[model samples]
Target: MAMYALTEVTKRFTKGRKEVRALDGVDLTVADGDWLAIQGPTGHGKTTLLQLLGALDRPSSGSVLFDGDDLARLSERRLAGVRARSFGFVFQFFNLIPTLTAQENVETALVPLKVSAASRRERAGRALADVGLADRSGHLPAELSGGQQQRVAIARALVTEPAVLLADEPTGNLDEDTRDEIIALLEGLWKDRGLTLITVTHDSTVARRAPRIAWISKGKVSLRKDDRRAARSRAVTTEPKDADSAAVGGAVATAEQSAAPVTTTEPRDAGGTAPGGRVALPEEATAAE
Candidate 1:
């Protein structure tokens, strides 16, 4: 069975008195240990879809099943426990607490799991070391560079030992060199730890690394071929407006093996943050999106 599956899921929201359908009849299945990339333009339900997959929000009309258990049917307390125990999320922004040291920031994730102080500290140190931040564990977010801060955020996500890692624009805020480093770290962790990685990214550099690519547009989700050459070529030749149009239309075919052209320069959201930082509930997600 698929590790996680969305069955005709539809997610709707109210934006300034207008009902916005973020996800409409979206069907997706993520198998265990798969590295899946979800790509699309901003405001095109990518973040909304991630919210559902991570159990941060429930679909409006359909089911989000995790190992065949329906998330919508779980109680709020149970859902919170599931999120803490089963999933790790890394946001585009570092989302680190300003005052906490890198190690302390990572230890925060263990608080809900009721880990002992000694065990939490040990695990946090190991997690930070895994991300190549062992020396920087005592530094605060302000003391570290952007890349270091992001690594700390990643360490925090890892401290929980989650089976799934949900990263939204994991490399969006870094320079080219730093972005490559972070991507390498993520890829290594995904392979070494046998984690199911679900990344929502616009950067073709990051998206192409995943073995499976899925496109989300107009609230629909469909699999597409992972073709880096085609994506890079389109990025060079097409105008932004025309590319956006083609992106929406070209990848929605039924057969699903056809490759869709991916753009390299997608417009970034202001503040360099995604709609939701980490775990967001449905009501909170409506405002964030």
Candidate 2:
């Protein structure tokens, strides 16, 4: 089944007398069980597409059919229900709750599921374990390493068992080594869980992992299918090393430090995993995980 189909979607923002159209008339589709990498130069509507898919924004025109349901027609409360139960996200920076333990932070994603707290705690622990953070679940974000914290965020996202997994620059904040680890982990998750995955990135390293690439420009989507060459030719990961200080983790993490003209940084500062999008300005991030 097609997981998402966009027809002539458009998004515009008015800045005083000047009206900005972030996404132009665009049409696209993503099938079930597809792992897609959304790639484009900056100012292309990569993030805008994610926002539309996540139901965070309504298109100014056109309609998006997700699993046969029109997202534009959903009520606010009903939309929240769809997002809560049907989709999960991973931000670029680990958006762990500062006050919660790794376990508690991960469990937060499950709170709305109405599962028992004990079950949440258990599942959260297992999710952390899946990401190689089993030993750090009891620690607070303060006590864990950058990679470990991001793992917690990933765990929280996975806890929901959503049908679709959306990641915005899932590796933007970490050093090269950590970035590679994160990519490997995502590939593992995609395989193990059979998720319908979509990630927006300007990183060729990350883009190379996807079997298909959807390039967006000026709020319009141009699709590319079955790009196995990138997956095969770009097997090695790109990353340097972790920074030595936490200064890299604060405002500079997602606030600044975008990659070059063609390079896009993963925006995770808002705690919404899918943050540095090319199609539009990153969505006003909602809840974490």
Can you give the TM-score per candidate against the true fold? 0.80, 0.78
C-alpha positional error of residue 137 in candidate 1 after TM-score superposition, expressed in Å: 1.0
How accurate locally, in lDDT, is each candidate?
0.79, 0.73
Q: How good is model 2 by TM-score?
A: 0.78
lDDT of 1 by residue, 107-135 (tens): 98898899999999999999999999999
- Tens-digit lDDT track of model 2 for 1-289: 7889889888777656866666778787888877889876565567777878988778878999999988988897888899888888877766666888999988888887699978997898898888888888889999987888778888888889898988888887788998899889988888678788899887888887777777765555665546433333233333425654444444333332232123222332222122222332232243221
Off by over 4 Å in 2: 228-289
**TM-score leader:** 1
Task: For each candidate in turn, give its C-alpha RMSD to the true structure in angstroms.
Answer: 10.0, 11.5
* Candidate no. 1 TM-score: 0.80
Superposition error at 276 for model 2 (Å): 9.7
**Pairs in steric clash, model 1:** none
Q: Which RMSD does model 2 reach against the true structure?
A: 11.5
